[model samples]
Target: MPSLTLEQANQIIAGALARSKASGFKPMGVAVLDDAGHLKAFAREDGASMFRFEVAQGKAWGAVGMGASSRALMQRAKDNPNFFVSLAATSGGRFLPQTGAVLIKDAAGQVLGAVGASGGTGDEDEAICIAGVESAGLSAG
Candidate 1:
């Protein structure tokens, strides 16, 4: 299975930041994770809050772990709030059901990793994530 390279991760983060800046969003924090849900790269804009890092990481972690976009996870949580909340606790608060992240898929639709962002509305965050994935020439799902 092919994995996202460090160069690719860096590109994604750079693109995300650029998009966020262009949209006039508040300073953002972005995170990229490998297929195994391990951190590949992370960046917090100079003015981004400290909490952005963890929120960004959790969104990416949830995407990689569930093999779906964080949007999907959010819908699932709405249908099963108890289980979803418990899942967050079970993952020790490392899982978040929100729409600021997406699974990274290769051309063959293989899961490569995930990208996530914080410091904007969930929609804005998700938009940046999708932009990053596309900028990296990967699919976001």
Candidate 2:
């Protein structure tokens, strides 16, 4: 199975921060998780709210656990709100079905982990995640 190395994770976080800063979005927090849903790396921009870290982690956790982008999860939640809500409970509140997170996929399309961000609009968050994944030479699903 393919996996992201520590260097790749760090580069992704750095790229995400740079993109967020360039866009002048509010300070941001970024999180990267391993395929097992364990944290690989995290960063909170100097002025970002502290809660951004937890939100970012939850988004990435949901992506890795469900093997899908957070956007897809949002759609799934809309289709079955109760089920989705229950899933969040089941995951001990770590599963958040929101935009701003995506699965990290390898060349063969195998999930390696996930990246997520907060401290901007949902679209801005997602964009930074995509930029980060691309910077690491990985695909964002």
Clashing residue pairs in candidate 2 (N, C-alpha, C atoms within 3 angstroms): none
Q: What's the TM-score of every candidate structure?
A: 0.98, 0.97
CA lDDT, candidate 2, residue 79: 91
Residue 101 lDDT (model 1): 97
Q: Against the true structure, candidate 2 has what lDDT?
A: 0.92
Give the range of the ten consecutive residues with the poorest summed lDDT in model 2: 1-10
| Model 1 ranges with Cα > 4 A deviation | none
Expressed as tens digits, the lDDT of each residue in 106-141 for candidate 2 is 889989999999999889999999999999999999
List the candidate 2 regions with Cα displacement exceeding 4 Å.
none
